[model samples]
Target: MDQPAIPRPRGRPRRFNPEAAVATAQRLFHARGYDAVSVADITAALGINPPSFYAAFGSKAGLYKQVLERYAHTGVVPFRELLRSDRPVADALAELLEQAARLYAADPETTGCLVLEGTRCIDAEAREAARNFHLAKEEALRGFIAARHPEAAGRLTSFVSTTMAGLSAMARNGYGLERLLASAEVASCAIREVLSTSEEHPS
Candidate 1:
């Protein structure tokens, strides 16, 4: 049999670092809320032009959504997973605060969460999407609470969900790990008080 010669590969693939671009976008997005970050800002941050950005990410909104997905899968997922841990609810809540602390300790310019920051910027469609995401997170936390502490599920669900939102705001406000832990301890104490109060009243 005659051996066919293998063809050499063609020219080099287009050179662009999507991860770098995304990280830049994430930083810019966090620094300024979604509405404040124009396409030009993204391009300027990535050191690229509008055409290149659109070519790479489809659109500004597309890139925004992608960065959001990155945060959701990486940041938010772990927060929700803490609620699912076999540890006690207070411990799980503390775990979430600990993770928040770790994030603060890691990122020098960390500015809390995007969804919390963008909640006001989101339009009708984006608001709906945010709502769904929040609801899903609540359901996950609630499921864990129901499974682990049925009697306190309702109160704990409300407490965790509401304070999660507040924690994101606190992060945006430049609250450090120590301040956040102090706030968490206070919130935990209040939560326990409410739980105990509710148990007594059964209302």
Candidate 2:
């Protein structure tokens, strides 16, 4: 008589790479907002099982936090370099907004900024994850402006943040680069006015 064969385990073989998984998740989250994506979607895309996904990421929010960090470090504007430049405050700010318009409209299919979109995410933890990047940007802007015009740093940072939000929103709404550039030009004028007025007031 022949011996009975032993049955093998059911689920797919585990070959998940956390870094590669993060990169894949980053794309899915960027293409579709955080709330829109699910663990099942990620697992399916990465060719892994549900248990493997949970074991690798802990939870959806956990993976999202990692994705947000990756996006902040790599995707968003290079604010530290741009804001800390040797150019005049008004000129630097104008360049900053102009650069933002270019980036926001770079890809028509995947428009808008990942960090900015996260601000409106329904998940509280996700929202905070995004806000941290925005706050860091504002702080960088504050430091740059304070070096030149100490009195106007707060207001100027607020203005820059608002303009960035608007630019991202317009890009997501299908606005082209030309329109975004026009908006950026108007914002640049406002920046000039603020700095010029601060110089005059000296309060």
Candidate 3:
């Protein structure tokens, strides 16, 4: 009296390399943005079906959340490292901006910062997700500046964030690395000027 074998599930195997899927999806999202890349697009790109995708990520937003985390670790600049407390704050910030420009324009096919660009996404959840990363970066920048230049922290942080956003937009609009570097240099100059002013005024 042997027991009957359990019936195998139908359709494509419910197995996919989640890490590989995230890597593939990051490229898609980076190239086309959040709203533009649909679940079907992701599935077709990954050679998997909706059920597999859902089982792996729960939903499009769920996958996007993972993608955002991946981008933060891999795609984004290492802010904590670059904003070293031992170095002059202005120089550190200048280097950070230059690095960002090069990275944003590094890939012509996938221009702009993924997390920054994702902030403008139409999906509320995705947009909020990106914003969380954006806000965290902002706080980090602020803290770095406040350590040395408490008075200039607020304005300098704002200026740096705004410049990075502009650089991201310009890169997305086909600006080459040379032009982006020029923009970054101009931003660096502005940051130095602000710091100089703050030092001179002593307020």
- Candidate 2 collision pairs: none
TM-score to native of every candidate shown: 0.76, 0.87, 0.91
Candidate 1: 10-residue stretch with minimal lDDT:
194-203
Task: State each model's C-alpha RMSD to the native.
Answer: 4.7, 4.9, 3.3
Off by over 4 Å in 1: 1-15, 101-108, 122-127, 194-203
lDDT, candidate 2, at 139: 87
**Cα lDDT of model 3 by residue, 58-145, tens digit:** 9998999999999888989889899887788889999999999999999888899999999999999999999998999999999888
Global fold similarity of model 2 (TM-score): 0.87
Task: Check candidate 3 and list the clashing pairs.
Answer: none
Model 1: per-residue lDDT, tens digit, 6-41?
987896444569977887887787677777788988
What's the lDDT for candidate 2? 0.86
Q: Pick the candidate with the highest lDDT.
A: 3
Candidates by TM-score, descending order: 3, 2, 1
| lDDT of candidates 1 onward, in order | 0.69, 0.86, 0.91
In candidate 2, what are the lDDT values of residues 80-189, reduced to their tens digit? 77875476899889999999999989987668888898889999988888888778878888888888798888998899889999999999898999999999999999
* C-alpha RMSD in Å of predicted model 2 compared with the true structure: 4.9
| Deviation from native of the Cα of residue 122 in model 3, angstroms | 0.6
